[model samples]
Target: MTFTAARVIGALMMAGLGWFVSDLVRPLMPESTIFGWFNHVNLGLGFLIGWAMLGPKAGGGLMISLANGLTAAFALATVGLFTQAINEMLRLSTRKMYPNPLRALEDIFRILADYGSVLLHPTVIGPLIIGSVVIAIIVEIANSLWR
Candidate 1:
């Protein structure tokens, strides 16, 4: 389905705000606390924010919201992965001689592989799926009632 301008803007805002908030709070919180469900919460917040801004005007009902939320989650994860890769690269560079392009690429891939495992962990995936489903149901009901 197509995303309206308002829905797109809302989703971007949600993702940006979520990332900003998560980054701000991540350092203050324990790693154990932020490891699994942080992305899920950010995604849920994205969907809620988008829905709140666009309401019935966004169209496509629950499915759209679910799709958008998942998209936002993936986006967040990708950004996190890249950020991790960059940080790792910089840290390594500081210790070693300058890395060639190939070495840098390899380092990024390695970091991505490591982060991928974390992303796919049951604790992370389970909560994200459950949360998205619950949010979708609630959005469906709200949209139905509003119409």
Candidate 2:
């Protein structure tokens, strides 16, 4: 789906804000911070922007997730981004009863996180979580607005 200028503008604005927040707070956070809250926030924002402007039916959220993941240094971010896309696709496929599918998908991510310490860069893991949340929130909001 073609992203309208509004979507791109909103997504970029949110992503920038997310990065700024993450950069500011990451230094004070513990090494073991659970889920990159900031990153997720940013990602959610991005998703919202894309989904709202491009239309949820256009698969914009999934595309945004992938783009954010690719930009990160952590393997966790990469995995989460791709997994989120898969999850989005699944939800898209089964339009009705998405609550269950969403839960299952998240559970899978948490399970994958168990093995993350071994492969993902320590620095990138937190941001990845943050990224996912950020994207999800944004996309959902935008999608709702559109609808």
For all candidates, what are the clash counts?
0, 18
Q: How far out, in Å, is residue 119 in model 1?
A: 1.3
Q: List model 1 lDDT by residue over 1-147, tens digit each.
A: 454455455555555555454555455444654244555566556655554543344346767767755654565556656765666666667788455767876787886776666656655555544444444445445555544
What's model 2's overall lDDT? 0.48
Worst 10 residues of 1 by lDDT: 50-59
Native-vs-model 1 lDDT? 0.56
Residues 1-147 of candidate 2 have per-residue lDDT tens digits of 556443554466445644554554455545775443546754565555433532333234656644543343233344344554455445444665446656756655564454344324545455544654454445445555664
All candidates: TM-score: 0.52, 0.29
Off by over 4 Å in 1: 1-57, 97-99, 132-147
Q: In model 2, what is the error at residue 106, expressed in angstroms? A: 34
Residue 31 of model 2: what lDDT? Answer: 76
